[model samples]
Target: MADPHIKSKMDWLDYVTVIAYRLGFTLAAPAILLLPWEVETGIPAQQLTFLAAMLCASSLHIYMKNFRLILQAATWGGLICAIFGFPLFGLGGAFVTLGGLCFKEYFCFRVPGLRAQPILLAALWLALVLNATLTAPMVVQGLAALSALLFLVTAVAKWRMPLHFDIGDKTKYEV
Candidate 1:
């Protein structure tokens, strides 16, 4: 009889994954938003964020689904592009993965405001990528801020959840 309180190696890994994901988003949001002082830090926040995203995806326990692996691949693609001097393309790909994760969270946990996250993020990304004059800068910033808030709420909620919530039933996982 194993002690229920005794966490396995996988359990510890899950906690680490959640921590990395949450911290990555927490830092990446401000950095990408061009918050004051982020520029001075001179750190590659985007690259680090994508790396954390990849770790999160790798540790995700989506039973009977390859979607998690797909997300991981996207993060890798984004990271590679970012490292090779294609920051825009890398950011685009990484944001897509982030949006996907938000959608997944919304689908699974029904977090408030998350349902609109992907759309808002996509619109913001498109506006920036296309340099669309049709959409005002204020609107773009508003969307980014909103998306960040939604992510913050979701991350906080997830942080409060037990590790098992993320790990789910190991029995159902594909071998």
Candidate 2:
């Protein structure tokens, strides 16, 4: 059976978010791999690559969609090793990228009416913070920490909101 949650015609705003999410990932993936190479070659390359990844991550926030952006960002960060290569910028990208994924997952749970296991949520937060601490600039560490903090706070705030999520008016939790 086809998934009922799939909307036939996505709202224009939703479509825009999906496109932005894809573009962010497209630019982010290669930059993640190439950024570290910049270090051996020169800081110039590293800076450029980091800039690309950062732009992608920054752009993705507007959409709030769990699209290609998440995997691409993670792939890029993995290629570079979370907290090391091109300086704090690389590390910050890692945090933003992974943190974005974590946020997306939480948002998904809200709609799916699925509660994430507490341990899983904790691990996600830890992974992001650890990655940032290892690869990001000392100055960026604070920013990354703040970003992580924001993710947690936002998730909690949304959870407390009186909003009741439904898959669609047609479907109920019990089939």
Candidate 3:
């Protein structure tokens, strides 16, 4: 029998990924309220949040052959766009990656509130980008708040799960 006390390299990677993932969302949850301060101080909370999120996404170990690769590509593509001054595309790509993660979590664990995350995140970004008069500022804020809460809940639940759960069956992974 495998010793439970023995921590594999995958275990360490999962712990680190979870920490980064949680930190990213924790920073993001208060983003709407912090926007004014971020703007005033030029702290760039949005960039930092995305950076951490990218790290988490890039490091994730998916059972499928190419799913993790696809996610990392999308994440890098988004981050590069943001760094190159394309904020809209950058945010869209990053959120899509995050939404993908949420979808994966929902599929794997059937976590409540996760299934709506992708739609909610997409809508939130679209409302901000379009600046639609029909979508009031308060509505945008409300969406942001809702998204933040859902993300926080998901992150917390993921953190609480067993480290080995993230690793899954190594034999099933494509080498």
Candidate 4:
């Protein structure tokens, strides 16, 4: 069988993606660390949820060097946040659900062309809007928007290449 693993066509866009990925992680790290660990009834569990979300976002960004793993982690993480977070953080959890949608679209539409990027980007936009509306902190809202934009731009710039590079011939999952 021929190998389906597509090598990244190294270019400025690839470099930009790496940088953007790193930047997203950097921004998400503080949010992860600062998230509240506990909450009282009647008080919004926003801090704790944000912390968990930040952890997932930063962790996923770090491990996203592998495309398949990135997809899986993002999907699972997003689902977890949506299911567990909604009760705890309300609309904030919905934003996480939207993020999962973005990651799913990114993997599902992985094609050797530029079309897949916009779909994924649209998902990111949904997430950003949700976050902006739910979270009161301007810093976090700004960071989330900037990170989403950066990743979207990076992915769009390299839409004609495989989303990640791995050498193999097995079909672990189909995009």
Candidate 4 lDDT by residue in tens digits, 44-100: 334433443443343232223355354435434544655674432342442343345
Q: Whose TM-score is greatest here? A: 3
Better of 1 and 2 by lDDT: 1
Worst 10 residues of 2 by lDDT: 164-173
State every prediction's TM-score relative to the real structure. 0.77, 0.34, 0.80, 0.28
Report backbone clashes per prediction: 0, 4, 0, 1
The TM-score between candidate 2 and the true structure equals 0.34
Residue ranges of candidate 3 with Cα displaced over 4 Å: 1-11, 25-28, 31-43, 132-134
User: lDDT, candidate 4, residue 76?
Assistant: 48
Q: Candidate 1: misplaced stretches above 4 Å?
A: 1-10, 35-45, 48-52, 132-135
Query: How do these models rank on lDDT, best leading?
Result: 3, 1, 2, 4
What is the per-residue lDDT of model 3 for residues 11-128, given as tens digits with 9 covering 90 to 100?
5656686566656555555653333245557887567657756756755767675777776677788889888999767877777777777778777767798889889878877877
lDDT of 2: 0.41
Pairwise lDDT winner, candidates 2 and 3: 3
Model 2: number of backbone collisions = 4
Q: In model 4, where is the ten-residue run with the lowest total lDDT?
A: 31-40
**Candidate 4 Cα misplacement greater than 4 A, ranges:** 1-74, 84-136, 162-175
Clashes of 3: 0
lDDT of 4 at 110: 50
